[model samples]
Target: MSFRTALVLLTLLCALIWWQATRPVGAPATPSRSGITTSAASSRCPMPPRTERGAMPLQTDVPAGMSLQAIGETNLRPLAGFSIEARVLGREDYRIGHEADISPIDLALGWGRMTEDAVISQLDIRQSSRWYRYSWKDTPPIPVEEIVRSSANMHMIPADDAVAAALRRIERGQRVRVDGWLVEANTNNGWRWRSSLTREDSGGGACELVYVCSITRE
Candidate 1:
């Protein structure tokens, strides 16, 4: 091949890689029930009531047959599991397993009015594992603290390839339903991570460590 042709090919390759890395992702794939196992005979559990804080509604329901299972471990704790349904404010994927293969995507999730595009459009949101930041041009429609409390940065660990692929497809500004568990992990080296049961809190140790068995965009 001519040197010119080789150089052009290399340039194109570089551009493609950059695009892949920086392009915005779309919503998650359609829901698939193929691998999901849930109890149809049992009655559906009631959704949790909205908090008085007036934050966005985050309803967590423990379906009749739903239960927690162990997927990975840390030095001091074993990552337990739960189910969650919320709006995707933002998402960040890890190419390298910073916390090992146990977790991959850092999902910024919100619900209720926070899910409304009209409301969210006024604010700018960004997410990393267990951390999220927001900004707005004018005064926010709702209280900033309310938005923060209504949303959470979840460290998601897919239980299988199907769940992983579904998560990978999720993009910002999409609503998602996730079924799994809230887990805690501990390593002998003193490193530990755990899921926070409440959304009203923030800062260190507040992120949910989830082992996702099934996930779908709504």
Candidate 2:
């Protein structure tokens, strides 16, 4: 190819890259375009009322999967319509990693008896490398089985910048209500990330992949 032609092509390529990098993923003003502002959060540990605590997340079946194409050729297939009011037991953010390309945050959430201060006080919670773990010195505070069923590590895929901002501001010990969908992402390159359909399971592959449409805090 001629040098002049190659230089022009290279300049166009650089311009395209810059535009893609600078574009907003979603703007706060246009949240309605993505979904409803259904989820929210607040700062720090003064717990929600008992009435707002202690309930299992609600998941509605989507018979056809409700698959939606997103992030290039990746198809985010909705496994169910999911909503949960729970305590933020832990929060982890990923900015530079393969997983961060899609889900940028992971929340360690607890509900049911796990939301009780009496129970929470007895446990030590920590999140690292996308895992949520809890422990208590001396005797166990509650049945290990109940703990397993009541808590989970969830991957959050913000539907828009509005959701992203809210999710980023969430703090541990705050009550959170998130409305969204359980999803499985499949890329054209055969990469896959799936959400666990059951809370009863634990260990690897147990985390929920949540595409958040709305979040609420405080």
Best by lDDT: 2
Instruction: State each model's CA lDDT, in order.
Output: 0.65, 0.79
lDDT (tens digit, per residue) of candidate 1 on 1-218: 99999999999999999999997443233424554322221111122333333243343544465444334444222233344567888888776754746787899988767777888889888775448878888699789788867777888876555566777778887666775556667666676677887778888878887766566664
Error of 1 at 51 (Å): 15
| Model 1: residues with Cα > 4 Å off, grouped in runs | 1-81
Candidate 2, residues 38-102, lDDT tens digits: the string is 33322111112222234578877765524544865667887877778899998999988657988
Q: Give the TM-score of candidate 2.
A: 0.75
Which ten-residue region of model 1 has the weakest summed lDDT? 38-47
